[model samples]
Target chain A: MPELTARAAPPLAHHFVDMRQQTEAARLGMWLFLASEVLLFTGLFTAYSIYRYLYAGVFEEASRKGVELWAGTTNTFVLITSSLTVALAIHFARLGRGKLAAALLGVSLLLGCAFLGIKAIEYANHFHEGQLPGKFYTFAEVQGPGASMFFTLYFIMTGLHGLHVIAGMTVLAVMAVRAWREEFGPEHYAPIEIAGLYWHLVDLIWIFLYPLLYLI
Target chain B: MPNGEHQTALEPHHGAGRYVAVWVALCALTVGTLLASRLSLGPPWHLLVALAIAAAKAGLVALFFMHLWDQPGVNRLVFATSLVFVALLIGLVLLDSATRFPLANPPNERTLRFEPPSFETHVQPGEREQGEPGAIGRPPARE
Candidate 1:
């Protein structure tokens, strides 16, 4: 593929290079997309920080008791392992191993489901304990009532991430089906790679969230 | 919509091992950040360290996880512009929050009796005399 020039007979993605240009273009788009994601989550992180500052003691105590560090840790490991598998999927796809890539993608999806299932259990427990935010929170251990704020952010942030996990799983499922069909090959596997990128970001966010919510 | 426009369909990425290495580095950084948070660091340092780690993690994700590092600089420029915009957005928000109260002048009158409509769901199950409809939503976490 010619550098920066439209090919007269381009077999590349309509918006990209021959395979080379397409890869670069797609990579660029993912970064821009990720930038947007960073900004989106930045709002939540900022809010959490400011709130923690104002109620440091309360949040500390809540952090110490309100959340299960083990649960969060397990989830973190789940995500990171899935990230590894997704990375492997991309690796295999690069080697033109579509079936393996698809299989790994499926494994990642299962792990994602496991993560969500754990998240659901955690959320349900919080709700049962009335660990929600605002005035409604009623956990016996969260003294000063202001501690509800921590749980509020906890639920909202993790809940949002859980939703993303669901979305990611749907994407993985589709890719797995495509891989099974032998659609992605030496010529086409960008979807798997992009999906890998998205999954990694999800894992990265959890890495931060785990400590923020669990470790004081 | 075009074939190349979306990366969803394509051949494998080059330098796959490099991206994998970056991902491992990211995992290490995550553990480091968690350890750093446990120290009795001052408030500013605590935030600084955490944010630094976050920046590193985000960089790794962007560079390798997303392969932006391998792409042309045009994409980087676009991504950077959005960063600036996001900073601006956050700055404006901080300014609004910081200046909510007058430093010098005292308020002539403040109303405690009148209830403001809340964006969050009612925190309590029962309704009070001043039942505000707007308050019926999830309680937004301030932190």
Candidate 2:
């Protein structure tokens, strides 16, 4: 009888007493996962802080000379716009506008791709200029004790963030497909909401990364 | 399909306008931070201003975009706790490094009394006294 009832109401899990409990549990679980993700990045942020403190001059010099401020700023705008789209996607999903939600997700996906494209160009410039990390760093202009460390942290922090961007893009792609299939509606849109949370988190991390790495 | 009661509890319905407004604010903050970075504030002020702007941007994303504002307290608490730990990790590490003895830091041009190890110069074994106070890998006295 419970199995039959669970089959009748597809959105509510067997353990959940109702849709409310189910959605709340899913949201709580997602938040817990996001919290863990925050901690993961926090480690790298701590490393950045320590190095920046120890070598303030070289870090600023490297940021000013080696980093492409325009590229970083452009990516920041791209991601903020993507985050808006994803949030709008969630809003539309809850309103049972599946097609519009899917389209918005598509737009967000393109924005994410644009961010990666800009990042690639920046990476190419860095490679050509010998602004590599660690021992591979041979950029003559910023050479010093802490100069390479600046690039080292730069590559590590931004590289990890790039991976997160890829992950967020993959999740958004899946959500878009699901939404297009009308899998998400007012009765059941936890997946889209959860995915939006992840995407927003990616944007949040980059918000800090842009300033800490590229700007100052 | 008498789940009408549950429908109201699923998630709060937010208008598209609210999100658009947040987006606009985010973009404005981004531009503001970019402009702030150009100023010659120097030292920690530049970093503080940049971080403050970034925090505002992040808050908008987390609260509105991520729906933390409508979320249950547990979810908000979970995220806030993680942020607290992040502050702790960064704060403690920075405090440790900032307060360490000058010569305790790695040998760098900026480090006070930072002297290159004598071994790098390939000093002959008998060239320096065996137990000299400031010889071979010893940090010079602070001025």
Candidate 3:
């Protein structure tokens, strides 16, 4: 192990031998939580697969006719950019530039809001056209037994993802406040890094959702 | 912990430039997928191509943005296991459906077991046959 530097370490938890062990434990715990999140989305993806496989024509028609591809593409770009900013926030935090880190996080938060705004527009369009889930579906352009099922999955999957975005934005907002307070520095920025992991996961889910739902 | 040794053994700190480069790559891939969708790849090819691009984009986000590239083996294991279960769930279910008897799956619209009632043909309860036993607004027949 590398020798400890002369600077005072953060207070080690009573249960851990050193700061390194505690940090590792925290990271591992976050990964475990993220794994569970993956499984949660996995179930929904499986449902999408089954329906798409059984009603291939319906999904194709639904994607081409109902969904707004431009919106999805734009949101993908926005999220990818936001992911970069959040990653940069962590980078700046590690360099002891807390203000810069907070600035990056603030940008990320704005991008997240933009994402939600675009989604709201799309949802409004769907609502106006009556392209809703299950029995609420009324758009008549695409017709088949599985037509409603497609919209149902689309709403459920994307709705759940949007909720995650809100959660991620909340986390980023808090991290931004802390970064602004200069609580994160080279010696301790795990909170920022962990929060970044979550925001990236939200982006990761959207990456798959775009092609599956919008591109078909 | 020494400030100098603060860097974890597995997780290397990447600079801002690396993140920007990944972001650019992700954006490019997003555009690539969008353009690919316009192609008349037909049925399975379209889905395969789109999913492949999505997977690539997701991989970039996870490895670079999420720092899985330099993460410890245990964290990687946790993620990989979750992915394994995902694959199993989708794969096995697809296999079952694919191998099922033709009649087990919903019949194609053209071959539906019964004709669905259209709005024009839908009957109102008030318009049902009058005086029929047990009909709406009518009394039941005695045994």
Candidate topping lDDT: 2
DockQ of 1: 0.13
Per-residue lDDT over A169-208 for candidate 3, one digit per residue giving the tens place of the 0 to 100 score = 9999999998877776665677888999899999989999
User: Candidate 1 clash total?
Assistant: 13
Ranked by DockQ, top first: 2, 3, 1
lDDT of 3 by residue, B1-143 (tens): 22354454324566678888898899888889988989878888988999999899989888888888877568888888988998999999999978885556777543364465454344446554654423443356589
Taking the tens digit of each residue's C-alpha lDDT, what string does model 2 give over B1-143?
A: 23334545465566689999999999999999999999879787999999999999999999999888877679989999999999999999999988997678786656744565565354446655665533554566689
lDDT of 2 at A27: 90
Q: Per-residue lDDT tens digits of candidate 1, residues A131-193?
A: 888877889986773487788898888988888888889888888887665555544566777
lDDT of 2 by residue, A1-216 (tens): 122223224466688887777888899999999999999999999998888888888889999999999999999999999999999998777666777899999999999999999999999999999998888889998978788998888888889999999999999999999887767656688899899999999999999999998889
Clashes in each model (backbone N, CA, C under 3 Å)? Answer: 13, 0, 1
Q: Residue A174, candidate 1: how far off, in angstroms?
A: 0.9
Indicate the worst ten consecutive residues by lDDT in candidate 3 chain A: A1-10
Docking quality level of the chain pair in candidate 3: acceptable
